[model samples]
Target chain A: MEITSDTHSQHISKQFNHELEELKTHLMAMGGLVEKQVQDAIEALLEGDSRLAERVRDNDKVVNDMQIKIDEECTRVLARRQPAASDLRLVLAVIRATSDLERIGDEASKIARNALSLVEAGRSPRGFVEVRHISEHVRKMVRDALTAFARFDTQLALSVVREDESVDSEYTTAMRSLMTFMMEDPRSISSILSVMWILRALERIGDHADNLAEYVIYLVKGLDIRHTDPDQLDDEAIQGKS
Target chain B: MEITSDTHSQHISKQFNHELEELKTHLMAMGGLVEKQVQDAIEALLEGDSRLAERVRDNDKVVNDMQIKIDEECTRVLARRQPAASDLRLVLAVIRATSDLERIGDEASKIARNALSLVEAGRSPRGFVEVRHISEHVRKMVRDALTAFARFDTQLALSVVREDESVDSEYTTAMRSLMTFMMEDPRSISSILSVMWILRALERIGDHADNLAEYVIYLVKGLDIRHTDPDQLDDEAIQGKS
Candidate 1:
């Protein structure tokens, strides 16, 4: 009446696969929440809506919960299945990705807070249009980074890295304009500072997007491109394209 | 002469222990390198030394290499040993910590680059002294976070999270000051923007420190305090203290 060794092995393998798939599903779920937070934070900035800002803050809790849940699940799998090699890499990557996504959520929350403060301070002066430009640039970078992650597209991920330079340039311009504004009128300094916070938050978001892209590169190519000559990444991508 | 079952079991256990120790040692080595990078990056900013900036930039390669090597070692151990339970958590934590350390290195590199750019722009205006305050605060946070990580002091880690608010405040002040300066004189905008870049980098360093602290908390308590109520962490720490 006892189960055969073959049957037991098959059952264990099935359970392991199910757990691994669940881990991926949970990570993707967390990614969805983080992506939504980023979108809403930017939308709040553009619309000057404190309500949306509140919503982003509220959702951070859910994202945090998912992170913990996913971590526990991964650890449980590691203990139960003791997966090796490629499976181990996937598990490790998920753990790292969860942290990155959680930080992305934090950045979004910061942006929301900044947006609320900006609305309270009133609209920025004329030259502050640069803030909008930076925001749009960063938002696009984040969007593309997430897209690259979802599709496992290293090319798109590399493009996100390349675009980081543009975001940096925009952030530089915005800072200069804001600095000039602060010096011109100390009276509006507080309000102007609020706008700067929003801009800074957007910049951080761009950085997080870059982190996500780096993960995509690691996931797809098993390459540690973190400190490499970004030019090398581009060259490799170019070769692949041809 | 065939080895007995008892002998084989003891050999395997000994091998597992050795691999676990090696993983820990490698993680610490990587941690040390990343911590140095963060310190050097801050020093570069404070001293306005482009040479130091270049060194930090180059050292990122070393950090990246360590990450890949440590990751590979962890994978090898996982594959060969099939570690379970606490051992599994330790391996996974090392993998996660390596990633956080790599990012901490990146943030430091960014600070160095900002310093280099600031130097290129000539001396910052006298009013930009607030950057010094931010620099000191961020440096302290990074140091404390790394210390907490090394000691596995959850209390210190939680304190790092609490201290982030002060850094956030300093960043806000710096942003407002920069914005006012930009509004006053468009001519000084570019130089002031460079200053803001430095501030932004420092703020991000503080953020990374907070992240390290979060990881430390996870490592010690096996609880994910991220995105949860800060009060929850505080209460837990207080209980631990009592």
Candidate 2:
């Protein structure tokens, strides 16, 4: 029934794709908000700004609303258009990427809550400067992942996927240092645990960003590259391109 | 074009719905696997079963495959049938629920890894019995969430959502105790931190379960109750029913 050749049919098809495009725009908007929230949530902790943390926390509802609206739009389009192959992949990718972005928003909220906890505990948390050092890598990973997804650049997506490993190693290093610090200084154990939790949240943000990049590869190549090692991904990329 | 009363059209529609039913059956099967993984992962921690922990970690690939396959089926159905309204809701819910299930699997893997870390750390890790008590509530929440989703029982979904609050309170209590224990005896800090991470994973599993129940409400009534407070959900659920 969708295999029509009429001019009217062609016009309708174009609008259908335009709807997919609109869906992407909404996804990017949501991505943009999540990106800002992550940045501010980390900064609020590193700088110990409860006021800024409160802002990040309150903006969570906006991100949640955008997620609902974007989901509704995706559902509407799937019902009306019934797109095939690549277009179908793109719509599915958008639905998934939106969920990842919303989760990124949730992680940001967690970071802010941890920040407020440290601030209200009436002492500046130790090793927050160290936490910032660790968070920078995750922040860049998130930014680059969003860029790759928007551009559909498999190369960039691949790079983001690879970056996740280094970020994960950095997480291990951070956790080790936190654990050591906790033992050596019992006076600061509570605050150190808070810092550890914040870093854990950042590490997870990197993970969600990594998952987002995988969706980009899946969108482009129509292959499941998840659970595959980054070293293997390089070979898979060559094969996919060839 | 789908708006037809002809016999052939009715037959095609029936086939489409059969596809949806098939998708549901697959989802339930995947849910069953994930549930077992969660149970085994926690037991690996509680009982210090390194062998079981490794098994849970290794089985992650199976869960990942199920998630990808289910997602592909949803995309195919959307591209072919373009189901509207309730049917559209059903497919979208399946896709979303599959992701949650996959995440639950990932968290299970994380828990398993934490268990191995404790086992390798060569310490039995105190406070684990307490951690088991906390995880019990989460495990039940997950079991009931899947039950509610597969049965399309909104009442059960509401209870799952309400149960999350108690699980959350237990998480807080457990965390506070863990922190106190860590500070009092720094010798066990390393193993204790791993236990804390496992407990954190359980709390998140509870959250994912809560999200699953929300999807049921979304599928049944087209209402987004994600950001709403549970106390208010009671009133909202009554309104949604009428």
Candidate 3:
């Protein structure tokens, strides 16, 4: 009887582990979709492809579905497994990461909307090269953040956090240049505002990526580093863990 | 011996219930603090009070602390109790709500930072009256969302979700006006850009608040209303709950 019971319990534990692994896989899948969404949204804007922008908008439904499925899977695991400590932390971190990913999807949708508007209104003064630069950095941040979360790599996560400042600077610079361009040619105000909105969306995507990296660090090191100075994160992260 | 065992179990269950209640009360407290932070941040911008803006920046630490405390309490409860079903839902909802609340604080800080920049740059056009209108709507949405969550009122939550569209419209209108104003007068571009960022922050605050309301609906009804049509939320929420 004892041997049978031990084997039964082992089976249950294996099931639980399998479910958790499934949850992580789903999250990573969702992350991949989000990255593609961001890339496509930027391309739609740069090329003034309203049809491509509409495609990005439509793809958002898929991203939102992934978020809903991942969340349900998480709650199911929590309800069934009753996981503690690191397992519980991992589940919560996934939930936090999903929120960021969903928001990133929303940002992508916003960018796509602006792209459609710019296309309809007629694009003017075609130079948002700085926004393109920022988009490159933003994409890297999201990719690094998802990788860090997947591998439990605190160092990669911290580097993602550090990249946020550069993205932010890029945003500021882009805004300044755009403002001057709009002022220099009033005819471009409508279209330029659309570009500004798209740039804002990209900058926001970077911020959400940074937040995801922080969640990764929190999951790996058991440190709540959301509002901490990026410079101080390495020290605090090392000092805190259970 | 059986009698004592039953009594002891009942006592422990009551203690768990009490702890859950305390967690809720603490969440309400945090909600109140976030609402005040949003208000103060907007006030700083509208009044051009650098001192008030500085105070809002300083108070963000308190907001961050509340989020950490609430999150720690949530993780502890989940680990200790292994709550299932609605009990599990409540804890996860609180965790999600805390993140939105914390982000509201971050947006508030961003608003304050922009307020300071605008103040230092010597106030753009003095009439951010449209931004004031948007701020009023955002504040209402936050207050209503928290109340909806606290009371488990799906009707209120649905309304908050619907209100988001109006906020989005207001943001678009404000942007158009700001862009036209910036183009009409080149010298004011720098200061007006600050106001534009502040408006964007407020618009984002409304979005986060709408998300919080959806989480409340999810918790109360066990249906994820996120990414759903706001028009459809009322019916779906009513149909799905206990």
Best by lDDT: 3
Which is better, 2 or 3, measured by lDDT? 3
Question: Candidate 3 DockQ category?
Answer: medium
List where candidate 2 sits over 4 angstroms from the true fold: A1-7, A234-242, B1-7, B234-242
Which ten residues in a row are the worst by lDDT in model 2 chain B? Answer: B233-242
Best by TM-score: 3
lDDT of 2 by residue, A1-242 (tens): 44555777889978887898898888888988999999999888877899999999999999999988998797777777767788878888888888888899998999999999998987875677667776788888888888887888888888889999988888888788888888889888888888888888888899899999998888888877877888876645533653
Q: What DockQ, on C-alphas, does every prediction get? A: 0.42, 0.71, 0.68
Which scores higher on TM-score, 2 or 3? Answer: 3
lDDT of 3 by residue, A10-61 (tens): 9999998888888889999999999999999989988888899999999999
Please give the interface root mean square deviation for model 2, in Å: 1.4
RMSD of each: 4.2, 2.9, 2.2
Reported per model, the fraction of native interface contacts reproduced equals 0.53, 0.79, 0.74
Model 2: how far is A173 from its true place, Å?
Answer: 0.6
Indicate the DockQ of the complex predicted as candidate 3: 0.68
- Runs off by more than 4 Å, candidate 1: A1-4, A124-193, A234-242, B1-4, B124-144, B151-196, B234-242
Clashes of each: 18, 0, 0
- The C-alpha interface RMSD of every prediction is 4.1, 1.4, 1.7
